[model samples]
Structures are given as structure tokens and as C-alpha cells.
Target: QQQVKQSPQSLIVQKGGISIINCAYENTAFDYFPWYQQFPGKGPALLIAIRPDVSEKKEGRFTISFNKSAKQFSLHIMDSQPGDSATYFCAATKGYSGAGSYQLTFGKGTKLSVIP
Candidate 1:
């Protein structure tokens, strides 16, 4: 089952414009939300994140707004540039499992392209 769904599988944005990607999840047990950014031939790195208790979190030009009741979250990139072009994945953690490991679920991913 695809617990997490992301919209706009791909996006094209102009330089200095804002890029927005949205994601929704079906599992309420998820407590931690993290967004990862990946470039070509590179591993995905943590971008920004928010917990269920917080509605929003921001770092630099990247921001994450979360809605606990709606089970949705979003990533907003301000002043998008060509360097920001890559694949972004929104993920959620379901705390610790019986196996003593955390269960993480990721969205399909969104491809972003920024043109000057």
C-alpha cells in the first residue's frame, strides 16, 4: 500500500521563483516528517523536517509546513535556482518497531527543474 502520495511528479520553475511540492500520508502513527533532496549520482540528504507537535519549520530558503490533523506536509523552496533542481522525497517515521528499528516510508518523489 502506498501510504504516502506526492503530487506533481515533475515540476519546472523559473530562477528565483518559488517551488512547491506537496505530500499526504494515510498513516497517523507516523510522527516524524523529513524531506530529503537528491542530486544526480548522489545520495539523498536531509533538507528540512517537522514533528507532529509543530506546524512549521524553516531553514534558510527551505521550509516545511505540516498539518497533523490532515496528515499532510509540504516543502517550499524560495528563490529556486538551477542548483536546487533535483529529486525530493518526503518521508515519515513510525517510531520504533518490535525489531528495535524505526520504520520509514517515503513518497514516490518529485523531480524539480529550475531554469534561468
Candidate 2:
């Protein structure tokens, strides 16, 4: 079974609307949650991340909402725009700094399209 699950394989949002993507993890050891945004022909780039201790984190138009008890998290795009059209991925991992090593388990991914 997949460690992380994401819903709505795809999404369509109108310009200036809000786009939401959700994910759930089965592993309680996952302490770090990160969301990645990928444009076609490019590797996924880290967009934002949150620790289990944080309830929510927002940076500019992007935000991440986390629920520790539920072992779930979601990404919210504020004022969605055509430029925001891309594939979004939610990932979880137990970050370890001792050896400077970490591994990530990613959700299948959500494709978001902002229609003008």
C-alpha cells in the first residue's frame, strides 16, 4: 500500500479562484510534510513545507494546512492564476539531520489547471 494518498487526480480552477489539494499519510513517523510544484519538462521543486507541530504555514499565495492527529495535510493556492497551472505533489518524510540524510514518500500528484 502507498504510504501517502492524494485525492482528485486533477483539478480545474478559474482565474483568481482558490485551488486546494489534499493528502493523507499512513506512517506516523512522518514528521515533515512538503508540497512540490512541477511544470512540464522540469523536476518538481519544493514549494512549501510544514512540521507536524505547525497547524498552518503560508508564504505569499501558497499555504499548507496540516492536521497531525488526522495524519493529513492540504495545500491551498490563493488567487489562483493561469500561471499557477502545474502538477502539485504532497510528500512526507521523517527528516534526520545526524547523517544529513532524509527520504521522501510522495503522493501520486494532483494536476491543477487555472482557466482564464
Candidate 3:
């Protein structure tokens, strides 16, 4: 299965608190891990990503912790802010999918709310 399912669907956290969302997949062929952040109706934007080769990857207040054997990954937002309130999605692809017929498959989606 190429499907990646995300959990919680929605979350509410106070500002400056940590926000976490999780995802799991059944596909073992996937090699790339990506997390996206969306504000609204627009498309999701790449937030942080890791590869099966790496255990964890982080950028600024965002982080992606991955486990290849477990076929699981998660996104962590540190000191989350109200601006961070949006939708987050976890995605998986066969590494670069080489841009032709195949594209990244995304999770259903998870909306997060950061209260001030």
C-alpha cells in the first residue's frame, strides 16, 4: 500500500508549547519522508523532511523524526505559535520519484490550532 495515514486529525496547543503529529505507512518501498505545512486553501508547503537513511532531521522549530523499520514518522513543532495554526501533512515517495508518472503520496491531513 502506498497510503500514509496521519493521526489526531486536529490538535490544539497553547502558544510556546510543543505540538506533535504522527503518521504511519504500509509501503516499504518509500524512501523519502516529507512534512508539509499549509495555512489555508492554498497548497501544502514543504516544512521538513528526512530520508530512510536518516533517523531524524530538524530545521529551526520544526523537526521530522523517522523510523524506517517501523514505517513511521512524526513531525514536531517546538515553541509553536499561533501562526503555526494550520494543516500539516506527512508524505512519502520513492525518493525523487524522478518527476514523471509518479508523485509523492500524502496523508489525509491534520489541522493544528495554537492558542494565544
Candidate 4:
């Protein structure tokens, strides 16, 4: 089963506009929510993250708002730019297990395009 689900397989935004992506998960054990941004020929880099303890987190132009009760989270990109065009992924982790390992479940991914 897909633990994490993302919407809008693709998105298009005008320069300086806001770009939003949403995701949902079914596992209540998930405690960590992270968003990753990836460009062509590059690995996914952590953009921002939030724990169930917090409702939101912001870093520069990027922000992550989480709703623990709804099991949902979203990424908001303020002043979207062409350089921000890439694939964004939402992920969830339950933290370390007794075996000394953790598993992360990622959404299908959303491809974002910012036009000039």
C-alpha cells in the first residue's frame, strides 16, 4: 500500500506566484514529514521538514504546513522562480525501529514548473 499520497502530478506557476503541493498519509505511526526537491541529474535534497509537534516550518521562500490530525501536509513556495522548477516529493518516517533502522515512505512526486 502507498503510505504517502501526493496530488497534482504536475503543476505550473507563474514567476513570483505561489506554488503549492499537497500530500497525505495513512500511517499514524509516522512522526516525521519531509519535503524534498530534485532537479535534473541531481539527487533529492531536503527542502524542509516538520514533526507532528509543530504545525508548520518555514525556510526562506519555502514553507511546510502540517496537519497531524488530518494526516496531511503541504508545501508552499512563495515567489516561485524558474530555478525552482523541479520535482518535489513528500515523505514520512516512523523513526528508528528496534532493529536500529528506519523506513521512509515517499509520495509519487509532483513535477513543478515555474514560467517566466
The full ranking of all candidates by lDDT, starting with the best, is 2, 4, 1, 3
Question: What lDDT does the true structure give each of the candidates?
Answer: 0.91, 0.93, 0.89, 0.92
Number of backbone collisions per candidate = 0, 0, 0, 0
Model 2: per-residue lDDT, tens digit, 1-116?
A: 99999977999999999999999999888888889999999999999999898899999999999998988899999999999999999998887333324788999999999999
TM-score of each: 0.94, 0.95, 0.92, 0.94
**Model 3 misplaced regions, further than 4 Å:** 97-100
Tens digit of per-residue lDDT, candidate 4, span 29-60: 88888899999999999889898898989999
lDDT of 3 by residue, 53-116 (tens): 8898889999888988889999999999999999999988885656544578999899999999
Model 1, position 27: C-alpha lDDT score: 84
Clashing pairs in 3: none
For model 2, what is the error of residue 90's alpha carbon versus the real structure, in angstroms, after optimal superposition? 0.3
Off by over 4 Å in 4: 96-100
